[model samples]
Every structure is written in C-alpha cells, then in structure tokens.
Target: MFSGNGHGKLVGSTQVDELGVLESPVVLTATLSVFRAADALLSWLMERRPDGVSFNPLVGETNDGHLSDIRRRPITEDHVLAAVAQASDGPPAEGCVGAGAGTTALGFKAGIGTSSRTVRTAGRTGTVGALVQSNFGGVLTVLGVPMPADELVPAADRTEPPGNSCMIVVATDLPVDARQLGRLARRAVFAMARVGASFSSTSGDYAIAFTTSDQPPIPDGEIDPVFAAVLDAVEEALLNSLFTAVTTTGVGGRTSHAVPHRAVIERLTAAGRLPAPPLIPESPSETRLRTTPARDEPGS
Candidate 1:
C-alpha cells in the first residue's frame, strides 16, 4: 500500500514518495541489472494496463561484482518475465538464490535471508516480515555475543575487505502511512548495525518498508511496538543470512566461506544466551482429541 526508503539504489522511489503508494511490482536484483528488470516490468505492466500511459516500477539493487561478472550485465527481460510468471505463495528459497546468488557479507558468503515477528497494537495483531540482501562488512555479532573474526572460515586473500552494500525490505500487515512506513524502514537499517554493518561510505545500505492491508492507520502514539518488531525481525533476518549461506566460489575463482554454525551455537550456549529447544511438532493423527480425558476414561 505504501513504502519508504532508507539509503541505496532504489529505482522509482520518487514516485512512491510523491504519490504515497506503490502502483507497481517491486523487483530486487544486482545493481547493474536493475534497469533491465525495471524495463521488463514496465513492459509487462503496460500490456496489463492497456489504458495506462505512465507507471513507476519499483526496483532495488546491491552490487554483486565481488562474486559475479557484473560487467557482463547478464540479467535479461526474459529472466524478469520468468520470475514474475513463476511467483508462488509459499516460503521463499533463501541463501544464495535470485538476486543474492553472488553476494558476500561480513567476510562470508551471504545472500537472501528472511524473518518475521508478530506484534499487537490496539488489541490487533499483525506480522512484520523482513528480507535482506546482506552484502556488507562489520565484526559479526550474534545475540550480543562477539564472534571473533579469526574463528570464521577463511576467505580467499583479497585486496579489499569483502562488502559492498545491503538491501533490506520490510513488509507488514499493520495499517500505516508512507511517513510511518519510512520510520519503520529506518529501524530496519538500524538493525544492520547490531549485526556489524559498517555502513561504509562505499556501501549502499537501504531499506524499503511497506504495508499490505487496508486497515485503518495506526495512531502515531501506538507505533512503538511496531518499531520494536521491525528491529527484531531485521536483526534476525541478517543473522539468518549468515547462518544459512554456504561457502561459495564465484567470479575469478574468488571464494567466500560460510559462517561456522556449530561454533556460534556453542558460544551462545556457553554464554547462557540460547533458549530452550522447542517441542517436537505433533503428527496429524496425534492431534485428534479423544471424547474423554485419560483420568476419566473407563480404561483408566
């Protein structure tokens, strides 16, 4: 319904701000491929809206040159059309897929990561979801525990530190305006710092926050919970990016290593920061209810 930007290469952002609405689909891709995606989307939209003269196609990007031949400019309109056609409603594939295929973060292979949180405001519950293209540098920290740089799997020796930019997208079902969504976007970026993002001068760190419902706008006084949810979700999303990403060899035979999950778990557990393990989910047959309680049954 509405959206906001933090900092990054965002095509069609001006229209979203000027109109207070997103009138087209949002596509995320490699920095150099953004325009191609937008052109493809615009053509697709044009066919759908025969009477429409103009439209703004929202496209966001982060550089993937460290791991991909970005100069080749390989993305095509057909690729964009195929993605649009293949869209489905289900859990998305994360960690080195789509736009995240060639990204590296915090000296490790990083890619698409997602997380969500449920929050209540005015007795109404809504979910805030975050997806991040994490390709930025910083000392990796998880749950307030420091993960020393030496402990990580080593990357191939490089002239520069591994990091370029990060693109975060936050989606919520809460009723909020463009201005409020902007605030939410800011929080998502702030969470980057928690995970050790330097927000370096050369790095492009940006967030886009949007709502997906028609409910009444939440009052400004009642927005704190929403902010907290955004912060938590974004932080978790970035961590997930690191945890799930595996070692990858990319352009020019350059390799980026994956984070050591066992090491992190061990550290967190030793620090008394890990939560208790969750209960095993019940099977469908086990979920059936008996007519009588066990203590009241004739067999008992």
Candidate 2:
C-alpha cells in the first residue's frame, strides 16, 4: 500500500507459512532483495511470536533494471512497516510502483496488476485472486493475435532475450494446501501467456498461490478445493495489473508506455476481451468479508 520514496517502504513484501497450513500476508519486491526482505520479515514475526516456530517468508520479485535505482537498494524496515500498517483490502495499483516500478511486459511499461473472479460453491461466494509484478518479453502474441511491441521503449531487436520476470501471487479464502497452491501458481502461467508472455529459460515466470480456507488441525474427512480459485484468481489479478497501469518516464530518459488504455479498449473490444467498467479503482480502505465461491471472474 505504501509508495513513493517519501511515503512507502522500498523493501520486498514477505510471507511466512505456518507449517504449510497457514501463510502470512504476501510481500512483493525487487529481484535481488528477496532474501533480505524475507529475513527482515521473519525477524519482525519472531519478535511478535517468539515460539521458535518456523516461518519462511514467500518473497516474489521482478527485475527493475531500467527504471529503478538498483544500486541504492532503497527498501527498509520503515517502508515494510508502513506498507503493512497501511494495507487495505481493495484493488491494487499498476503501471509503475512497488515491485513493478521497474518492469516491462509485452514490450511496454508494466508493473503491478491484479484481478479477481467469483465462483459459486455450496450456495456461497468465493474470490480467486492474482497479483503480479509485471516484467515479460515484448513483441509476442496473446491468444494467437500478434501484438506489436511497445515502440516507445524499442529494443535493439526481437529474439534479443527474455530477461523479464514476474512474481505472480494468488490467494483465496478457500481451503487448500501448498501442493494445490503450487498447481494454481503454474496455472497462472496460462494467464501470463494470455498477456503475451512465453516461458523462456532465462525469464523467471514463477507463481505462488495460497488459500485461507483450510484451518489448523484440518480433519482427514475432507479438504477444501482451492485449485480453481487460485488459478482463476491469479489470471484475473494479472489482468488487473495491466488494466490499472498508466505510462511512466524515469531514469536514462527511458519511456515505458503503460498498457495503452485506448489500445486496450480497442483491441479487447474487437476481440471481445473487454470487461465491464474496464477497470476498478480502490479506495484508501476496503470492505472486509469472507465470501464463499463463485465463477466467471469480473475481469483480468
């Protein structure tokens, strides 16, 4: 939730799994600082719960080589605490901020993006969610359609390298375990592909998913379903990141045009990829509830 060198923490977001059954909140950050962020986050938690419990922070990241001050290494405890203190439940920001501040996607400016879907289960409602640090190769196809690379930040050539990376995080209130969550993470790749990303050996296209549905001491009788929720949610969230972002200009006079809204509307409309409202903006605060399950995501 925190941003700007003045107001936000520059450190990576962190999460700690409680014996593979529970996970702390997710954290996003730059590619090289995952360990530092995780260590700091672990320290904060240990001070809060000094029970000798083991908790490994789930840190995700993308390369921020173009726009960020990579050498400064600006993230700090204050930034982490501030972001945590100000966390809210609602739409995530996109374009250039957080871990995405220095990333690219489909050959254009890219950053954080999120989307959600509703699923129906047992006569209730549930939300499958996704959040991504946008950084992927450019000049590719999405759903078989050729997408010209963002000319704004033209690369020297195509087939140069797919150095971009993405930290995809999927979450749900449904019950599921790490194994299932891992599957959901992999499924997120499909969504990324929808956005015109190919799995190059060099690109770190990783996804991490989790569900709050399962509680401690889960009984052997039954286990909650989470794959559908995580997969769908992550897809939506990744789309949200692209949909919400705006273009940015930074160091080296480098210009990275965000997913052009006009182009988005035009292409999606033509392809029937448009969703209602086109996008949603979150408030400083968000609603708190535990909706069950539903399907057909809002947009992504």
Candidate 3:
C-alpha cells in the first residue's frame, strides 16, 4: 500500500498527480505525477487572474533506483514546487538532482543531463532551457570518441542495468505552437543519440516542449515568431542539460560518474567549442589569503 502524500508533508494515499494546482508560475515533479503536479501547474497558470485558464504543463522524469528508494514514493508537493521555484534562468546544473534522482543509463549512473547551443537569427536572440530525466542505454562515446573494450561492460553482464526511461522538457520564451514544439521534441532524441544513447528497445524516450511567447489565441495563422523561438531554445536547452549535468551515483551501490565539469570545460576548450576559463589573480605582496576554519590535519 502506498503511504506518504499530504497530511504528513506527503499524503501516501495521494499519488503525485493529485497535487491539484499551483498558485504560482511553473512547477516540476518527476514521474508518477502525470496528473496532480501537471494539473496544479496548469492551474497556477491562472494565479494572477481569477478567470478560467488552460496550459499544457511541462514535466520530466528519469527512474531513480541506484540512489533513491523508488518504492517509497517520497516525492511531495514541496519537492515539486522546489524544483520549479529554484530553477534559475541560466544553465541548469545536472546529474542526480531534480528528475534524475534514481536513474541510470547504459547501466551507469544516469539521471537528468542538459545542454545548450547559442544561435543567432535575424537580429533578436533568446535563451532556451532544457530539463531531462536521463535513463537510457546505448554506449559511452562523446564527440566520436571511442569507448575502449577495456571499459566496456558487456550488455549481457549480470550487473548490467536495465533499459531505462527518460522524459525531456523543453521551454522557451520563443513564439511557437504545439506542432512546432512537437517537432523540436523529436529532434531532442538525436541530441541524446550523439551522447551515446541508442534509444534502447526497453526504454521510453518521450519529449515535450512549451513556449512563453505572448500572442493572441489564433484559430489559424501563417508565419509564427514564437514557433521559431521554440526551435532555437529547444536545441539549446538540450545542449545545456548535457552541459551542466555532472556525473552522479544513485541506489544499489552503483556509481554513476558525473561528467566531470572541469574536465568537460577543458575538452570543449580543446575542441575550440568554448573559450578558456579566466585565470585567477595572485595575491599582492602585501596581501595574504587564508583558509578560514582550517580543516583538521592529522599529526599536524
């Protein structure tokens, strides 16, 4: 019997989808929340106005087993709101957080990973955001890099992980409709492929997208500025998810290495895809820096 949900921070009897609606803008929760979290988020779309409202909510998920107790149903209203409320406009940090708590990829630690690319069109520029629940299996190869047989875990290994599931949520302030957004979602599958995921047979690779473009409801129309924005943002957000997610380790004693952030930055710089990190300044002759509350040193 499921337990934690509301009366006790999480009423166990209440499924994640039972959250109803939010009184604020944007909300997030992982799987099992196909209803409550999504509905509440859409409900929040009308927070400012008492008038009726409708919005297709954005939600993403990755299976969490290696690091979290999947059977507990620990996710709660507080957790969903926290994810959305804490979301920053800039690049999102990745790996083992948010929707990735109990996920795995190719038998390794995989949860949510994001990546983004900058695109310049016409004269206007905008940022696209991507959130992912990374749980799939293919192989581990980055930018045509080879995975040595030594590091290769045979797909049939007893310890090998199951083909997992993932959900990608793309958001843009761009002007676009549901159809365009759907196309953008499909493209995201390719982006994942580039990072070593082959869309396993037992895995589910679904994606959804939304836009914040402000426009009058149209029964039908021609060119769409918002639609264009969605494509641009979606492309970038996927990249960002891949970019910011560090490797992680979750449940079952399996360790999922976060793509080391510093190492990735260095690799990007080598590929000329990124500029070098700025240098740190040395202290002046008259100035001295010290580590506060020095850590304990044995036999100091």
Candidate 4:
C-alpha cells in the first residue's frame, strides 16, 4: 500500500515518504489521541506480523478541539481495534463519525464524505474512490459555483475552528507505483481547490492514494484519465460531506450547521447546472412485425 500525510501532526509520515509503502492500517483520530491510536495500530499489526519490530503505524489527525473534548483523549485501544475489526466493503458511514465526528468544513458542519469514479484506459476499466475527512476552511463551492458564505452563514453561526485541515484518502484498482500515486495525490489537492479551498498556509490538506491492481504501472502519458477521475471524485466527495452533515453542537457549546440541501438544488437548477433526468424505456408494440406472428401462410 501507499500513503501520504499533509499539514497535520501526521505520525509516520516520514517513514511513508522514505519507503513509499504503508505497512500498517491507517488510523484517523483527533490530534490528542495520535499516540494512543498509533499504539493500538501497532499492537494490532504485531498480532499479524509478530516478527515486525520496525513497522510504522500510520495514524493521521486534524485538530478537533473546538468541537471535541480533545484534551480528554477519548480514543483508546479498544476503539481503535473495534474500528479495524469491523472494517467492511458495505456503504461507509459519513459525516460526523470517527475522525470526522467533530470536524467542520467551509464554515459548515462537515465530516466524512466519500465518492468514486470509474475510468477506462487502454481497454481496461478502473475505479478511483475518495474518502475525505472534511475539517478545513474555505469559501464553499458546489460544482464550480461559489456560495455566498456571508449571506448563507452569518458571522454568529460560523464556527470554523482554528488549524483547519482535511485528510483525503484515495483508493484505486489500477496498477500504479509510488511515483504515479504521488502524482494522483497532488491532483486531489487540485480537486480541493476547485471546491474553493485556498490551501491556506495552515489548512494542512493531504491526500493518500493507493492502487489494488498488480499489473505493471500504466505509463505516465496514460494517467490523465486517472487524474481527471480523482479530481471529479474528490470535489464531489467534499460537497457530499457538507450536504449530508447535520447541524451539530459540541465542546464549549459551539455549533456548526449543515448546508441547506433544497436551497443548493434550487440554485443549481436555476443556474442550469443540474443534469437531465434519466429517461424511462418504453415497451415495444405488440403490432411490431418482428414480434408478431404471420398468418399460417407457408406452413399450410
């Protein structure tokens, strides 16, 4: 596996950078619980690879102090193991859960959001999936249209926490090496920019992308499709995080509110940006010559 860490206090980042490989499960948690989370991950990995003494437990984080009692360091070994044990391919829980439980994005109650895209290249189809912990600040945009933040979110309701951060994890089924994966990760940052993130000096936007396929890496020239897919998926995923979140009140009674869905849809529709609805198929007519039985002509 391959991985990356950006501006946050991301543990094990240097190792991943030096070796270009991920040797353990990536655990995401609040800044205060990075050590406990890492210990738990290391303990879990040791059970599987008993001889591995130098394995780097990859754990990442974004500051959630404003909305979470981070000083309490609530994440424990049990919580970490429970997450690893229950991992599955079913639909993921998004918006205000796990590491995203106390996150905000673009001045909204943002959390976990995920999206995927299928790309075809050289007669092969691959899927690129993005899961983002949306805990950063910026002007909110949906599908390239900017939202008037001041009008939509008054100063009183805005609860953008300090030390803004976003963690983007990308998974693909295409065969790509560390170098190519790094390129893909950079494109994810571009996706963030499209959604109106400024990549502020401290926002700490990071992306980690890995491929599941074992085929030889596709040449650099053929990677455009994958890059485009990553961009589209990351943008949609960020928007989804905001759309699915509910207004939440957390530490110090600070509150973050979810974006209004109906209003966004209306705006998009008014802007002529919504795609056409799918058309339903009509049944064939019984009188169609191909399906109708001819008179008993030649048989008689």
User: Which parts of model 1 have CA positions greater than 4 angstroms off?
Assistant: 1-8, 154-163, 275-300
Reference-based lDDT, residue 61, model 2:
64
lDDT per residue (tens digit) for residues 1-300 in model 4: 222235677788777767778887777787888999999998998999987767789888887766777777777788899999998988788876777877778877777899999999866898999998888777888876777556565653654654488888888999888889889988887788888776666777777777788789988889899999999999999988877777776756677766766555556666788853353222111111111112432100
Q: All models: lDDT?
A: 0.77, 0.56, 0.47, 0.75
Best of the two (1, 4) by lDDT:
1
Tens-place lDDT digits, model 3, residues 186-294: 6555556655666656566665555576643222343244344444443344334443444443344444443334444455577766678795222121221111112
Candidate 1, residue 117: the lDDT equals: 97
Question: What are the models' TM-scores?
Answer: 0.86, 0.72, 0.59, 0.87
Best by TM-score: 4
| lDDT sort, best first | 1, 4, 2, 3
Q: Please, what are the lDDT tens digits per residue for candidate 1 over residues 99-165?
A: 8877888876778999999999977899999999888877788888877555644434343354578
Lowest summed lDDT over 10 consecutive residues: which window, candidate 1?
283-292
RMSD values for the candidates in order, in angstroms, are 12.9, 11.0, 10.8, 15.6
Model 1 residue 213 distance off true place after TM-score fit, in angstroms: 1.8
User: What does the lDDT come to for candidate 4?
Assistant: 0.75
Question: In candidate 4, what residue range of length 10 has the lowest lDDT sum?
Answer: 284-293
Error of 4 at 91 (Å): 1.8
* Strongest candidate by lDDT: 1
Off by over 4 Å in 3: 1-58, 148-160, 215-252, 258-300
